[model samples]
Target: MSIPFDRAPTATTDTQLSFDSLGAPLHEVTFVIVDLETTGTSAGKSEITEIGAVKTRGGEVLGEFQSLVKPEESVISPFVARLTGITHAMVDDAPSIRSVLPSFLEFSLGSVLVAHNAPFDIGFLRSACERLDYHWPQPTVLDTVTLSRRVVGRDEVRNHKLSTLAAHFGTEVSPDHRALSDARATGELLHRLLERFGGYGITTLEDLAAVRQAGWAKRQAKSHLAKGVPAEPGVYMFLDGTRRVLYIGKSGNMARRVRGYFNASENRGRMAEMITAAQEVSCLPCAHALEAEVREIRLIGELAPPYNRRSKNPERNSWIVLSDEEYPRLSVVRSTTALEKSSAIPLGPFRSRKSAQAVKELLDTLYPVKRCTARVTAATLAAHRPCVSSQVGQCGGPCAGVTDRQTYLSGIADLFDAMGGDFSSLRRLCTQRMTRLASEARYETAAEVRDAMRSAMSTAARAESAQALRAVPEILAHSPGPDGGLDLAVIRHGKLAAASHVRGSRAVADSSAAIRATAEWVPAPGPFPADTDSLPEETRVLSQWLQTATLITEQGAWSLPRSGANFHAQESGTVRLGDAV
Candidate 1:
């Protein structure tokens, strides 16, 4: 009787899954041992005089096929005839090469092929098939000579030739130049080589094919190192004996990804150095691919592993934060701490500080906002005269009371609107200024306007990316696990607040509990205008995941801003905000 249980499963190991799941057991693989006695060596010049084959599986012989085919040549070579002991009369009345091929191919249609040296036999077979308009069955082929070299080693065996290896392995059938005898010897040699392969953990045709290269065979023992890593989506770290991280990476399958580094075909220069230096591998399981990706970046920035070339420093981030003041002014700030406490509208997590500064400069020229930092009181505002910025018409002159508080605040309000993807006023002003400068032969001034316009649009795009995620109040999403189960995540207030695993029949209950646990939990808004490193680990991880999440509720869907990049295209005529008094 079979019993069903709902317990969560432990992680699957390398031995259980192996390199990849083999479609069938090795013993069940059908093998056709083939030997061809040709008139001479080269398939282009020589013709096959005899064909012999034995089909077997798991060391049991299933069938045999033998044929003597008449060559196009009138007589065989004296040396070949003597070596193979096949006279001309033996094949004189036999079927032709074309006629004999169909019967042999039909016998071995679905079998793996084994030969002393496969290329020599396959070449002759392929040549005949090509010449006669016959389709060659592309069977899985193995070369016993190559296998013998790996199995017995050059030190143990005199040579890899069929006759020499056959005697050494003590096969039941001895090798003679005759086709049938050589075929039987090869079949026995194949079984012995396969048994030796088992010692190296090669059981299937894929394993045999993989280990054919000396590089693969040399690293076979080290392949077990992959066994320690679990198969799941997460960040993997390679560390040296001193416990220092050599390299950090993320993948959908941590075990599979780590295993690939040790593969024979690995050709990266730094990868070789990392592999040799690394003594242990560490993994941190993530809720999903997005979390894994963010964690990878976070780790690189925090540790600054020498092998990592990207996202090494989170401190390099920049943001355009609207100031928390009576007369608000947009300023580029690198301090995440100042941003979060200022209660200002934070519009980035930009890649660089210069990019944030560009947008700040663009907004300042596009809108008539006060720039003087002196605390503004009705008494102080009336007594103070305008600064040079006011004289130049760069500001509305709020400090001099030339502009009323409500009037100046209205302009500041418009700046906030511009930051939220409405760039109609800014675009019009920038284009008009550019056209006027170009018309007056001030080409450099025109280029500056053009560049500022681009910076404004690019900044708008980055803000759009972040705001879209914030529109969703909360999300409960699940991603598929390696074992037909789900990895769950709970994002509250647009930040990944909690994550857990639920396998089998407990998905619904566990998912609800996970969301409820974080219901009252408000993740910190976190230090803004700073690099990825300054953000709380939970916020960084969740923010990345939410970027790609599918919001569940209609409230979440309809909450997003309807405007896009096209919203900026609404400004058609050139604007003269810069020249306006």
Candidate 2:
């Protein structure tokens, strides 16, 4: 026979009822081990089929409460029924959750709640409490699963399951799988775990809770420190309080390397500047440290994070092209133009003007071309004032009207063709020059031509190789962020390499801002531009690296191309006075 309850009674409506029965406490501090058999995993769609509790004190069972709940849901799954042995027919006449919850709460008074995977049970209970318009006071819930993991050393136990724990402690558990039976078994398991690990500073319930809460973080930090992240590696990301990925980087020993960011006195100032801007740290732990280098390069090309040093301006992100007009004048144009006009004939989308000019000089040295800014026009030639290039014989005196327009155009066309993926033209020219020089016994000239040919071939080959690099995963482009400007930086191993800055329109920006406000950014693959032969080595390397590296951005889905540099222009419009422009 069950013990009679002695607690104040409460009035109830047709849908609400109360039960007040107190169970005995366990240990110096009492606990109520509780379990619930639910209709389904989803608390919203399902209802509790059974509720069970066992209260104990000083290693002795004081009292127990069990009830079958008639759920509002019309049907329960066969699997749930079999697992709990609580069929719909059996619970058809049973009390409702609203009628049973109060009774359970009364029995659980003056006791800390304990269960295996406490969140699973507590989550359902909390949901029910919410539906009943009751603010369930947050209880000091203990999880037997976590306690077992802590007590039985995470690695030593193949499984910390209830049955396994019971077997391990040689404690007999009857009527297993039922709510009341499981609750009793859990109570026993907790007793054994507490006794075993109690000597190792797990004496108090609060101490155990703290240990469990910090379990994963402590374990990971220890592992990272012990392994000693190497210095010869690639990139890393520094995340902050908001879990916002604040920075991406490449370095060997990323852990030891990143310590510098936090170790200095200046760290607080720098971190304070970025912390409110971030939350939750994460990284791509690479095997080969150099993989970090490669990853860093890929990341910069892709994400274009704000903190990276690369230019965020789209207009500045351009390439040098040799124009197709007569005399083949060199021109600086946006990288986006190269994607639109296939015949612009590019030399580079180099990181800087200096790098682009250096490449131009190298090309000029290998293949003789006019380097002067002087225009070779009919009027200028007729005037007979030989341009500086003509005086130096570098221009073939075209400005002196010595060359026809047809010839000038042809020469310009040939120059562009040779530079634009026509390795054979350059190769043929180099070979012819080498042959002529060799025939003249000018071996040095022949050697120079051969070396130039080799470099040109290598440059061509690299470009072709870059073309073969695969497109990034489609899901990557869907990263969550507001339509406000987003800057992504790609770091490989540990070096800053590539970056992209994206701006969304007001409409799109508004949606993205809403997502950001809620802090619901889900990582997605972003568009990674491909490396073209016309792009400089640094840009190419950065582009390829960005393809593989981690991306961090605010929330929005704006389509961008996978190759060549291009930035979306924010549509021009005037804001009205009420718009806070």
Candidate 3:
């Protein structure tokens, strides 16, 4: 007589099944071992070539189901056919996905779904379900791969592949890599794993279903985020499984940053750690820089992200200015408060103590201002000798304590003048010195003054370069043509350092606005020049063309090539050499 594959009848007698009676403590539990042969690796366009599943409960084999499905796409690859032994002719008469998916679903029901690398199988199943508009509520998914990893440890298991696992478990796997044979081997492997590692933690069907659904959702979300992220300004938030925010960050380009998280091979060490810990990702888009900044601050405050607390703290967003008194001393102060208190005075807001120190060092190098310790009075100064700064004439001999209050106050005033963004006074001083030297017929001294002036001007030029580069505007023009196009370049020291191809008129306008907004900013060192001659011939030629033909600027530069049509002088855009690229 043929064995029945249908569901067994439930007991009508009123006897409850206890955990012990159900064989809860036993090494073996029910599992529906599953495997699929597919046309390709990608689930998006690929179709299943074959399907196989075997149901077992309490270490007893119950039933088996297998079928070959005709894939909708034409031409199975030669390699795929060779590996699966399922040729194009064999599946030509087989049912389509619509006809076969229901049967597979029915067979997989009421048993834990077991597979090696469950993600691969589930991904394809989910994709197929989506395409067919079928609702295959996730079954309890038990990945022997994950179980083996846990039981054998990652380092000890050189190969945890299905065939490897079958071999390791001493099960002979015939027709390897094919769906039905692989499914049978997986069933045997599951039996050995349960025996070796104790019964799976799965209990209720609902419990298994919940775990499977959650895992599926996570995988789907990750895949969607990876493929669907937009390349635009936005803020991203990372959350744990409990939905508690872990980190928040803003990027001018969102897709690139999102992709960075999924780049396993390149960022394997870091990504491996992050992916295992990360539960979900959330993102928000911002239309502009100010909008993005505001949104970021508000979300950071609302979420109280653990990693962004430093930026959110009011105390950390402060500036410190050294007090100018008989004893000059460092004063801790808030940026907004200080800016409000002394609207006319110059102050520098620092993000950290290290930043503050760096600013102080820059001030000392540029201005050589006095920074004597507060404790040193005239009497104390007389007892000790002068410090190195005083000896070098960089300091006004504050250690000697001989200078009057007025003179010290005057020096402070000079420092304040320099810090107030007023270089005119320094220019006047150099001019006066040059005039005096010229009157004495000292051409050499005059030349030295000229060199000093160039040096000073270079600083201003560098500041302009920095400002231009920092706030690059959106491209205003986007078409590829001669008349309405803008050539952009990032110039350093009169040489083209970097170049970009921008065509949209709107992009040009946006980029111009961005550059203007950051015109006063200073450029940082190590900017890649677009017009460097060291590059390939074509790149070098392009760089030179952009540098000489296009308007160059310290901040950034742009120019629209002259269109052939009659262009009024006022209507025509003029090119300036000092614009940022």
Candidate 4:
């Protein structure tokens, strides 16, 4: 992908001179207004017969370059002669294009070049440079046509053509069918356009570039608000003039994400308007993206910023609850309160009903958790006929009295164990089945079973851990931090109760009381994604780290890091828990 000339000649050219001051004063910038007359429209098919340039600064012309270039085309087309008034006889005595290209390149060096229709002029020059192996410097280019389009309304000027603008501005010189005359007129037009550019804050060379950039000038006025954002994993809030949160978002690098709001690539008009309205930006640094993500979700649910459109409908969240019947059937429901009221085993805070359904379907594919929605007692089972699921062997057929209530309940307990984060037995069984299927050349079936098993494992682990954390009355834990310190956190019913950091020799002892976090701002937590996504690939790191997090219970007894929560899978010879959001 390297270009033939990514860098210019360092020894003789001014290309290496530093110009870090993209915000230099307007008078300091050198404008090399250039124009070209060619034999035809396209550089690939035509040859440059003449090049004209006028370099200026502070409304004063510093130098000028003009040349007639002879091409290999011995005769000019009648149309080209009539248009540019340059015939073959005119350029016959002129030097070849290769000889004139170097002078023009040198004249435009270390300067912002201006042309009426830049691509036409610059394309011709670039073609000559490429053909002759004369490395062209990457020069700053300004198009007068584009500048006029930005500065003058169509109602004021009929068009941005050189003749039309020259007449409209009343410049001393006018563009003719000649290179030098047209270039001089275009240069005057450049000065006129620059005079009106102040309203756009186009005081710098970069500012000049932003004028023609796609919607970039609109964002320049407010970029200072994001300058203070830190470059680390965090949550950012955009605030309006009234200090109300306009948007809440999470990113691994807060500064970078905030800066993206000012970029031209943001295609959504709503996003653009939101950025324009933003007057201040705030940041909340996090341990990692996970903490930021959870905090963002909770905050959005709490603040309900108008610009944030997703994860705002917690009322629509679904959970998988095992119905409390003699023949319990796995089901999906929508309320968090149902967990305590129904006395049924609950396993969710799924983002959507579709996700809950997918997890349920995956579980059913691996384990026959009776797909029938029927309520069953021994009498009811004996009286009713089995559904098609029973005939197809997808269900255990407890409704037809084929399997007794106790055996069916035993299966339900197994389902509970499988869903509650105890995945060792399921893994061993699925592994055996997958290996056997592969050996029998049923690769597709093996893949299906393997995928379903993995999906169920992830879902169960996520739901069970989240459920277990939520069910806990209170717990506290400490982890090592930078510089021989400890970071302490208090957990109550799944969300943080308090958090703090202690440094130096008093770290361990002071952490219990120095803790500084609260659940007041933490929105009620439940139903989080365990393993459903990736953005920039670092998303799962925090999740994997949180899986086996140790907790000190309120009763001073250790349930996790002591007795298993059963929500962990056996990997190799070790138990690994699910990733959290």
Best by TM-score: 4
RMSD values for the candidates in order, in angstroms, are 11.5, 23.0, 22.8, 12.0
Off by over 4 Å in 3: 1-234, 249-274, 285-294, 297-322, 326-344, 365-368, 375-394, 411-414, 422-581
lDDT per residue (tens digit) for residues 1-581 in model 2: 10011210111111111221112222477889998888888887788888889998768899999998999865778987777778989999998888999888888876799998888899888999999986687878889997788658656656988887787777767537788998999988889888865554234554455444323322323222213433323366655555455667765455545544422212334443443354444555542333344455445545556665542332354455665545655555665545344344564334456545544554565443556666767678779876676676655556677667667656556566655555445555656777888999999867766654544344433433333322221112122222233333423211222222234333333433332333212122122233321123333554444454444441233233332112101111111211110
lDDT of 1: 0.68
Q: Give Cα-based local distance difference scores for all models.
A: 0.68, 0.54, 0.53, 0.67
Off by over 4 Å in 1: 1-25, 38-49, 71-88, 123-138, 223-237, 247-278, 283-467, 470-473, 479-487, 491-506, 515-529, 532-555, 558-581
Candidate 3 lDDT, tens digit per residue, 1-581? Answer: 10111221111111121222212333344678889999989899789989998888877778988999999985689999888788999999999988999888877776678888888998888898998999977776878876566455456557888766766667866438888888888888876766644333333333223232113222323534444555555577777788887777676566656654542212334334445556777776543222234345545644567655534542353344555456453444654444444423433334455545544544453444565564557576767666677777766666676555567657656446534434455456656767988999998967766554443333333333333333333212112323234434333322222223334445555554444443222233232222111112122222334444434233334332232111111122211243212
lDDT of 4: 0.67
Q: Write the per-residue lDDT of candidate 1 for residues 1-581, one digit (tens) a residue.
A: 00011221112222122254434567989999999999888898889999999999989999999999899874697888888889888888999987899999999999888898899999999999998889877888888877777778778777788888888888888988888889989999998888888887667676676445454555555666666787767789889899999899999778767776664345466766777778888888665565576567667867889898877766666777777776776777778676775534565656678766766776787789766676667787667778777889999887777887688887667677666567667777887888888999999878877776766665455444444444455667665555665556655554444455556435546464645454334433333432211233334355445445443322255233446532453233222211100
Which pairs of residues have clashing backbones in candidate 1? 428-575
Model 2, stretches more than 4 Å misplaced?
Answer: 1-26, 154-156, 213-581
Report residue 257 deviation for candidate 4 (angstroms): 9.7
**TM-score per candidate:** 0.57, 0.35, 0.34, 0.58
**In model 2, which range of ten residues has the least summed lDDT?**
1-10
The true-versus-predicted C-alpha distance at residue 91 of model 4, in Å, is 5.8
